[model samples]
Target: MAAAGPGSAEGTTGQSALAAHLAFRSAIGDVSGSTRRLSGELSRLEASTPGIAGRASGLFVRYVDHGVLQLRWMDAELAAATQLANAASEVKDPDMQLALLRRAGPRLQAAMMGSLLLAVWLDFLHLTDVALKQHIYSVEWLFVDLDRVQKMLKPAMTALSSGESGQVEAVARDIPALVGHLTREFAATREAMRAGAEKLQKILVLKESIEAITLLSALKFSLPSLPPSAPALLGMSLTVGGDGVMMGTRLVVSAEWVEMMRHLVRAGVLSLPTVSAAVRIQAGQVMMAQSHDELPKGVCDALGDGPEVQGMHVTGRAGAGMNEPPRHHILPKEFREWFEKRGFTGEMDIDQFCVKMEQANHEAIHGGGNWKLGRTWPGEWNRMILEALQKAETRTGRMLTRNEILDIVAERMEEYYIPLKFIPWRGP
Candidate 1:
């Protein structure tokens, strides 16, 4: 067989590199599509259950935003690499072709690492989605358990307080068994939530590890060669082969990276903050119920006697306290005409729909004083609510009912993290 010429050799190398590049690009595309789908699913889940999916929603927002930047950078680098590879394929000179291919190596490696980081990110998203759903289901069951226990206890306590001997004797006997059942169910649910949190923590650690690797790879591609002193500055080895060949390049994690990881692990950085918040909220609810039960009957009755303002039983006089904030209309009074045209024509006076909030928070909602809430603030929220109303009307080709409008308002309020208590009470 005739010996292969320089052209033939260049053709083989270029073809191989180009094929690899195409495969990596294809993988990136597949992963990108998966991320988008997963993100949409997470968003819908959040929409359905606002505060329940807070942790997962926060992570998705943060990482997806970061991923966008990384992917863009990777795409640009890979495209440049492909161009270099193509250039090498056309050139007949052996040394020039090698130089071009060498230059392309770092870009390819950086892009490859970026793609892997995204794959890890995709796994994180999937795990978070599963974990969030499980937690929500478990928490819902816990609430059910609490409700059942409360229902069982209330009548027994009432019987005891009212001095009804027969009713007391009847319920007292069942109390022990009921308490035992609640204890078992609550313990099991707590265990499940704990396990789910641990899983999330593990995935969070894995994500960080991959991020570190990706960052080091990027440094390698950008710097190509680091002096001996560079290790101290970057806290990682950034050396490559003398001939500029990136194949078989070894990256040594610096002491700093290991120590930083240790610190984060020790600090419980991997623990989901939102999960902890949910647990605290649940605990607070139980405490609140207990406190309410402990209140004197007269006080309980008095609580209900507070003057009704905008459908809320205002327990405290508006001007009784220092620096009392005035009540603000939920739907801005200025927009009353606009809202009436769409569906605010219910029996309840539009002006009376108000919620008492802090002066700063109230002002922030109305686009006052350095409002920096981005797309979720007064401006975007206003647009969103109006659009929702418009869409609802268009779909039915009729104005919305009072309840329907309130439902829309509630959803938007939750979406923007406004307190749900601010929504005017619907009559029983």
Candidate 2:
């Protein structure tokens, strides 16, 4: 066969690039539709069963909104890539055409990163759906049992008042049995719900980690080699403009991403193995182990006294051969007056609303990190919690109850990838 000229090769490469772009755009559209549908479903679930559904439904909706924003950015980049590809095709000089196509490489890579992020998010949504459904079922069953017990109570009281010995005796026996059954069921359901919530939190951390990786990848922070078990790059050719520049399919592990992952691993957000396993889970190549129920060591260390206020201790007390993490005020101490005005008064000592945390995690939350993250994530979390509190008070037209405030704190912690165990426990 005669050798293909540069012009002919350029034309063929451009065509393949266009085809890949179109396929990716189609995939984005599909994911966008799915995200919108899931958001709507979650909204409905949140509205209908606000009490039982808790915050997961609403949190997912917010997550979907964030994902959609990412998709919009992706679409813009893809459009740019398509335009550049077309421009390359119109150029007569092979060198000029090649240069134009080369310019599209980064754009295409960005779009690909967005696609990967959306795919991971969609997997998270599926997992959230399952967990939320289970939670709803468990709470609903508890309500049903409560109603049944209430009905039984009235008749039992009547038999006792009427002095019907045999009836009272039988009724007493049945009541104890029912109460015992209810207790056991409630404990089981409560434990299941807790586990589900913890699972969702860990998965949320994984999702955020993947998002960070994708962003880093788009910024060209990647190794020439791929990571272990990394999936194929959707069978798309990354080479463009007749130059052998590989723009995609490399493992993205920027120094910043690596540092953040190291911090997370050390802080017990998720273990290193869990991170790898979770990625595989998103790729549909593996399942999470059921036996992984214990809180991360960092979390356990933070929850030292088990979320209870067992009297006040020194903020950063270290024991022999042990480094004690510093205690962080869940509601910042500087905002103690503000929280008190919003009903942290009386028995609600803001000082008691604290959790132990590794120094790095604590510093990060307080805006001590990379300038970009410090400006955004930490500030965003603070704003979110404050806004949530303000909105709740506005809706109820009153200061939040103690439990209500605790619930808000807990929800925000989960949303921001903080350990739920950090919230002060107030009994079951």
State which candidate has the highest TM-score: 2
User: What TM-score does candidate 2 reach?
Assistant: 0.27
Instruction: Mark the regions of model 2 whose C-alpha exceeds 4 Å error after superposition.
Output: 1-56, 136-428
In model 2, residue pairs whose N, Cα or C atoms come closer than 3 Å (at least 3 residues apart or on different chains), thus clashing, are none
Model 2, 1-428: lDDT tens digits are 77565468646644444443344344334434544554454344345333324563443454444445555655665565566555545444333333344344334433433353344343333333444554533434444543443344445434433322233233322332333333343334434545655665654543453344334231112212233354454222222112212224332223333333333333222233322222222222111111122212322222232333122221221311135466566776656777887666532456535566787886677567554565466355455577788899999998876556665675567565675333232222
What does candidate 1's lDDT look like per residue over 209-235, in tens digits? 334433422122322122334434332
Residue 105 in model 1: lDDT: 42
Report every candidate's CA lDDT.
0.41, 0.42
